[model samples]
Target: MTATIHSLPRKAEPSLEPLMTLVADGLNSVNTVILDRMQSRIPLIPALAGHLIAGGGKRLRPMLTLASAALLEYGGNRHHKLAATVEFIHTATLLHDDVVDGSDMRRGKKAANIIFGNPATVLVGDFLFTRAFELMVEDGSLKVLRILSNASSVISEGEVDQLTAQRQIETSEERYLSIINAKTAALFAAACRIAAVVAERPEADEMALDAYGRNLGIAFQLADDAIDYDSDAAEMGKDRGDDFREGKMTLPVILAYARGDAEERKFWEAAIIGHRTSDADLDHAIALIGRHDAVEATRERARHYAARAVDAIAHFPKSDAKAAMIEAAQFAVARRY
Candidate 1:
């Protein structure tokens, strides 16, 4: 069925001034460390690696890593390395994702696939993946490696599953959520849990952190999907309606299709499943979907995850870091182009 939020005008930017300040500082350290290490690699690797490393993003994963650690009162500066490693792993995945999806743009610039071609993007992504492994080894923590390795495996497998399920009208929520866990939630869970694993926190604490990351990731992805309904190319940095244009069956379309009238359903079936959608057709589809509550339902789901994320960090013992991590969940739900 349709949901509600997108029918309204944009809300005020979520109050993240305090969290932004902390998240920004953490991001700065993460960017420096990640860029420096990426450049240290062999030339071809560095050029490709640096290309994405220098690209602008919210840098949420590294922020999650460092914030979780600080909440646990980690004393060593080694969290910086893990934070950079997190970014490397994230950037590498994006490289592969663009190539696999044949995307032309990301973050307001040509995707590596568009600029360097698919082959270079794939190979460079592989290089960065290897580099992340090498750096993880330096940490000398089997626990860290275990977390990251598992996440990487899941991410790869999840991507394959999503590709396999493409244009799949029969996809269920259980199946969709499973894919989300693999493609999106895995790394988020790992990022938060890695900090706890490193800090020697209680088992309960680690589990809670894992929950925080998983829910945060889910919220972020859901919000991302919501934006696709009317995403502004200049602001969101990608073509608006890219997901719909690709026939990806994101939450909005899925919800709308399920609840649509026969004519509405036929419109989607022909334009989407039948592979005949044009830009004008896609815009019409977005407006039709909005006539229902599809986008609002998706936002509500995102807010649910955001709330769960906040609850997950509740037991972390209050600190600026802890508060900011909680606030990040809200930020994920509320961000706009």
Candidate 2:
């Protein structure tokens, strides 16, 4: 069934800009670490990494690490290093994802793979992955290392899972959740959980923050999937309907397929499953999704996850940082791009 924003429950959201501003100093430190580590004698390594890293991406994952640390009143430099590590992991994933997805644009600019050869992009991604581990080892905490390392493994597994599920019309919601959890949410969970670890906070607090990040990550991905069909390339960093073109079985596609009539199901099977879609077919797909309110339904689902993310932080003492974290959860679902 179709749903509207007014017809479904939603959580209050504040803009992410304020959250970034609140942690501006910490984010600056993270950026410095990112710049320093991207350097290499090979020249191309730093150039390729910097192209995307300096690209106007939001840096949300590292900000989570910084904000979580601040929320706990942790006053140490380790979180800065760890935040940079989280960003490296995220940036590495983006590099690999562009190659895997064969995307031509990133952050409204030509993709690194489009400029530098795919081999270089892939190798630079490897370089950043190794750099992340170096930072982790430098932190000298087995617990932190274990958490990020496992998250990295899960992220790779998630990518493999997504590869397996491509153009799969019958991909179930449960399977989709597993893929997103591993590819996207796992790092977020690790980033926030390690914040509590660095602060020497109790286990309960760490788990709570982990839950928050995981749910927020899920919400963020859901919104991104929905936006792919609705937003302009300039706003979304890629062409509209890229998911449909790629035959990706995102939540909106899955929902529209499941809710379609027999003839409509055939259309989806042809376009998404059979890979016979064209630009006109994408337009029809968008119309079908709108008729079924699939995009709105996905956004509503994102709201549910965002609410859970906000609720997970209830135990933390009220502070500006804590409030900003809560708002960040809301922002995940509410953001247009």
Candidate 3:
């Protein structure tokens, strides 16, 4: 008798829809605050800021704030304004980042700096930061104010550190993690910690949420770095190989360079130092990354952090909010764009 063979079903890819659905109403309120606060007497201020604010970002940072509040079952409207503040801080950073990177595209559209000019973009970024502070002050929570303000400062310091590391192939994994922890993860931690403050949750709870956000942020950044070199990856809004061309010294480059042979090392040295910048050069770089499995290695690193993010909230009683948070961390590692 011949036996019939059965194939196992593939696991479905993780998605952000559950988290988005959980925070939908709260996010709507946050959007209202964002639109109202972003308005200004100076037409250019609103116009330039609106260009990026209306851009197709997932608004992940603020959504984390809202979701954290929901997880705590917090019944207050204060988080809406605070969530908007989180978004302002994030948007300000993006505006400045595009200008610093000399990017041509943001959220699949022309970057604010390209359309409004670098000076205007920078000023608008400053305007958003001021608005963020105003919102924090209006909330009348010194603790909240401190957390967010410190995050803003850390983000700036991280940006400066990354600028110093740019084109420096000597940038170590430890140093790169330090930079991302401050620049990218700091705001995520702040966003989640403030939810505990609003909910009157204990310090331990606050720390737990902070850990979750921080790890998730690192995972998100790592996945993004891997995508920049992954040939089969979908377009991620920004120009492909922007990190390579800019010599950002991301994890993939670090791994590939470390694992490369002598001839490959020579090619990487030339690429990182601005000697190789053509499309052909980028193709070769991608090929080298593939040969070393650097992209997969970076993604594996992301999965590690994503698992930590999930465990950070594991003690919480099972609820829709908790499940959504767990899935969000999985999505961070699994996302291609």
On lDDT, the leading prediction is 3
* Residue lDDT tens for model 2, 142-207: 999999999999999999999899988889989998999999999999999999999999999999
TM-score of each: 0.92, 0.96, 0.96
Q: Which stretches of candidate 2 lie over 4 Å from their true place?
A: 1-13
Candidate 2, backbone clash total:
0
Candidates sorted on lDDT, descending: 3, 2, 1
Error of 2 at 41 (Å): 0.4
> Which is superior by TM-score, 1 or 3?
3
For every model in order, what is the number of clashing pairs?
8, 0, 0
Per-residue C-alpha lDDT of model 1 across residues 138-185, encoded as one tens digit per residue: 898998999999999999898898887777766666677788888999
Candidate 3 per-residue lDDT, tens place, 15-71, comes to 889899999999999999999999999999989988998998898999999999989
Q: How good is model 2 by TM-score? A: 0.96
Off by over 4 Å in 3: 1-11, 231-234
Instruction: State the weakest 10-residue window (summed lDDT) of model 2.
Output: 1-10
